[model samples]
Target: MPQSSAQVTAAEISRIAGVTRATVSNWRRRHEDFPAPAGGTDSSPLYDLETVRTWLASRGHASAATPSEELRTMLRLRAQSGGSGTSEGLLLVVLAAASHSAEELTAATRLPDTEVVDRAQRDAESAADAVPATGPVRFDTADAAVLRALYACVRDEGGQAALGVLAERELEDSAASGAYRTPAPLADLLAGLIPGSPSRVLDPACGSGTLLAAAARRGARELCGQDALPVQALRSAVSLTLTEPEASVTVRAADSLRADAFPGLVADAVLCNPPYGVRDWGHDELAYDPRWAYGVPARAESELAWVQHALAHLAPGGYAALLLPPATAGRASGRRVRAELVRSGALRAVIALPAGASVPLHVGLQVWVLQRPEPGGPERKSVLFVDTAADGPAGPPAGFGGTTPPARTRGTARSASVDWPGVTARALGAWRAFMENPDAFEGEPGVAHAVGVVDLLDDVVDLTPARLVRASRAEVDPAELSARVDATRGDLVKAAKSLARAAGHEDWSAAGASAREWRTATASDLSRGGALTLLRTVPDSVRTRAHAAGGEEGRPETRAVITGSDIATGSGPTGEPTGLYDGTAPVIAVGDVLVRAIANEGGPMARVAGEEDAGALPGPHVHLFRPDPARLDAWFLAGFLGAEENIAGASTGSTVLTVSPGRLRVPLLPLEEQRRYGEAFRHVHALRAEARRATALAEETARLLAGGLTGGQLLPSREAAEVRGQGGDSPH
Candidate 1:
């Protein structure tokens, strides 16, 4: 593939030319010598990369793409060849960098483009064993840009970043995102279960090796992993090697359950979070396999199979923690195996987590911490069951399955996030106490319990923590619960008042007939016309700097940074500012408009900076726009930029939809008319803010009241004598 033939989108051209989308549009309309569309639709056409560059150069425009973006663009173009040659080239970069000393590799990167390409080819041939079989690694002048970016990425961000981009592109092509990566909190919590730093750790289905990485952080000297996908195996290998340079890393691309990659190897510890609802996990063929020591897992008992597999590979008395779906604890067909696990003293603990703790966000998952029973080990009498499913606070409102990560940790507010820190504390506390003395362990009321193994040998040996430890109404304190309900009710009353005011301010009516259409211009065009100035924190700069700038490397300090999370919550700059940030980080001013970089549900996409937000620096995942105020209103620009359709139109990326500031379009209305629209949008923002607040308070109030009433703390007000039956309305 020729470098010049690579195609780029209009947005890419805008980025490369250091101009806005509007400027690109203006160029297309005004210049006859502009590059023609090489691909894509008429509305969103792609142009030949070389032709566009020549045009830009002829027009005195400089290339402004960062190294990563340039490499990404080239990779997308290389994919048009329907081959893996470019990927092999990328892999070559990582391997070469890893094989050579940092100074040597840095010296190599400074070589002339022609010599560098040649050196990369030689390095690829030398280190071919490190990467998967991707076609022959070849590099041409066209790939020089990618080669340079890859070296820089490997050096600055580590090999993981370069490999991550390749993995993302491959996943997008395959449309197969295996089980989501294990959440870091959950991974650390699982790793903390192992008493001492085990010498060896293995994850049979390590999606991205998150579990193994966590284990390494806990002092594991050797890490082994296998996955069905080659990309994942490679990623895990590179990531683990980078994570623990001293640990021995061995990753294989295979189906571990069927292929048995390390059949004779026994690990000191095994941590796994296998795929759920897998009906075809080699069930029939593996019926006679020896790993099924507990029992032959039923066809629907894939989780049980993983459980047994983890147990099979563990050394005597070694620990294995598996993240299983909630169903595994109570499934009827898997009852026999469940009983055997308990009877053999292999099952140690079953902790139920709250919903939103991981993927399949609606159903709460369970973590099964087990150990291989040793002949000389102390008698195992009980298994710890900690039901932390409701440990934090309330979850989202009924049926509210929003996909955004929770922005705030307000105790009773509902969001799509689990209180991981809180959950870790409670679960670990119970487990540690139980381990010290299982018999004498005094568990927290309604939260954790140590159950006797003898009591769980029945036909239905259910291990569900919720079933065993749901908060008992009789155990709750009447005075405390009643006081909580009253406090919640008072807050709800205030929220209701605010909601009423917001609701009353707007009596929206429909456009009489057909909806009116308006002429619009891209934000880039507006910027070119001096209507606004667009700015974003330098991509890839903030994360590295944030870590380097941490107060002590554990907690990030972002005292006055306006983060994307803060924007999602619709608050006035509650973000902390890291000491280090992008060199061009913008300090926001009042009336400036801000937009989130990532697309999500349950929140508005854009917000107008307020007085309190005036001097806050924008976070990496945020875009800032300072409007002229004479030509465009901040609210009007934000309103249109955040319109559902406009956002959809401008967003890109496979998993996380990122907003392109230049691509966002707005209506070209007169200043006065824009103000009129801005006023309505302001009211809309107010209405939405109040609605969210009211919903959160209402849900919290209802949950607290329900708990109080069910726990016998509060009596129904005048039951049969209530007004509904006798006066205004029928109870039914």
Candidate 2:
């Protein structure tokens, strides 16, 4: 097939059109102008890109597609040409964009197609020269459109956008399974599990390099990664280079276990979300592999193999965090290895993350934090076990040490709606406490515990955190629990009153005269005029110092980092600041407007930084907009930018929505007029905060009350006694 004749699925058409998939199906059934299928099977047919564009244009739908979507269509066309050259060319374009400023990329992309292609080829060659280890890349006129799209994507959405396009195309081409990405929060959690700042980090199965990126953010200087897929390796390389340009990165395309790319490499920390459940993981071939410091893993215990692989790569006393399936803790075949790991003090902690935290969301995944033991280190006494599954929404399933299952499911287990911040706090707190004093660690009831090594080396070596945490909770003093319940109830009552006041605050009237149309300017336009300055975290690079002070290799001093999750959850910064403070990370200030670079369905997408948020640096996936107070009102900008429609309109991507800060429209109104709206928005924010507090308090009160009653810690009041007397029943 010719490159220009490539076809896209109906789903792709819907994505380009910014509509539901059903809308495209309706177009096909109802409109004769709809493009006919060029190829593919009945259930999943493909359409010619040009034909679809022509049809969409004829119906005035051409303006619906974002630049990224258009570029995706073009890349799909090139990919269907029966060659991988176009993706490589696009990769080159991304590299070039990263090398140059956003303005430079925009200027180059604006040139004639021939000139753009020529420029892309030159830039690609230059990028290859800089990274001499990568194979040579070639670009031609056929790649011109993609080059332009790639430039636009990088400029408008950052390098990750371009990487995402290439990754999607490659994943589609390869038809890879078990290819789910580690959510940023989960990756951060894994990286945080390491006891100290690691100078060098390794992720053996570094899919898309998300974990490596997270590690880098945590001040890891030298990053090593290996993946079985070439595209993934290439993607990780480009992504890391672009985002963490200062970091030294080496990524290889080969199975880490089979090829052992970094055989002699011992890193300060190793983080992996390895592929789960592979019967054929070279068990026979690696029978004598020294990486298995613990008992040899059974063929069915591939997760255990990854556990050991991670451990093997860790420097003595270094930590390794691996995301594994729940069954890995108790699977009979892996009991010997689990017991050995426990007895040897290699396993430090087992954290049960909530379901929906990662892929295969039905099962709550576990993160096993291990330490490569020093030959003469003090005998390890205990391992931290934390169960955050019941700490968030979609609480543990029936008989999983949680309250009785609700009549109706709150949501599908696959939904990404878990309380990540709470989970991180609980797990980290427990781990830290246990690390400080394992023997005397007074664990959080029903949440975390430090289990003795002797207890874990029993007949059935079940290392599940929930099981251990539940047993520990049962040992808590009833009087202490009652006191806690009393305190929580008092707090809940106060919260209810506050919520009522905020909810009743009605300060604004409806706009008259049919919504009052007004002219507007984009955030980019305002930035150009110096009305505001937009800032984001600099990519990790060896040239740049790590965030924390006293970092290895003289890295820069670190500061508190405000993550996107923190903004979404309306919490203070929770992540450790590990990157060098080189002024690239904007220190947030009161009156500044902060917007999440990624859009979510139900939440305020932007916030006016308050006094509490001031002095904190913005982290990755967050946009900081500091307005010239004389020219712009922070609340006004946040009010409009955070609007659901504005966010939806400015976002790109099919699955995860990436916000285009520069393109987000803001109303052009006088400061006085803006203040009125800002005040209203501020009130709304207050109401929301109060409501959230009240809801949390209510849930906590219910849980405590239930626990108190069920555990026989509290008795019914006199009112209940009178009711029993009326029913002619004697009190026991």
Best by the TM-score measure:
2
Per-candidate RMSD, Å: 7.4, 6.8
Quote the lDDT for 389 in model 1.
71
| lDDT tens digits by residue: candidate 2, 522-578 | 676688789999775653332232333235444354667777766766767755565
lDDT score for candidate 1 against the true structure: 0.74
TM-score, one value per model: 0.72, 0.80
Best by lDDT: 2
Look at candidate 1 and give me any clashing residue pairs: 22-525, 558-576, 558-577, 558-578, 559-576, 559-577, 560-577
User: Model 2, stretches more than 4 Å misplaced?
Assistant: 1-84, 100-119, 122-136, 152-158, 172-176, 391-414, 508-521, 525-559, 575-581, 626-636, 667-675, 715-732
Q: Lowest-lDDT window of 10 residues in candidate 2?
A: 400-409
lDDT of 1 by residue, 1-732 (tens): 223357889877865664456678988999888889988999889888887888888865644444445556667766664433556456656766654554565666677767768877887787666544445777765556566667766655456557766666666522135646786678988998877889899999987799998888777888999898876776777667654656888888899899978998899999998888889999999999999999999999999999999999999999999999999999999999999999899999998887766666667889999999898888888898987675324222111221212222332212453545446666777788788889997675466777889888877999989877754445666887687667767877998998899889863578888998887777777888899998755423224434445643433344477767567666555444432343345678999999987774347789999888887888757888899988898898899998887877666566456676776779999999888889999999999888877776676567567766666777888866576567868647
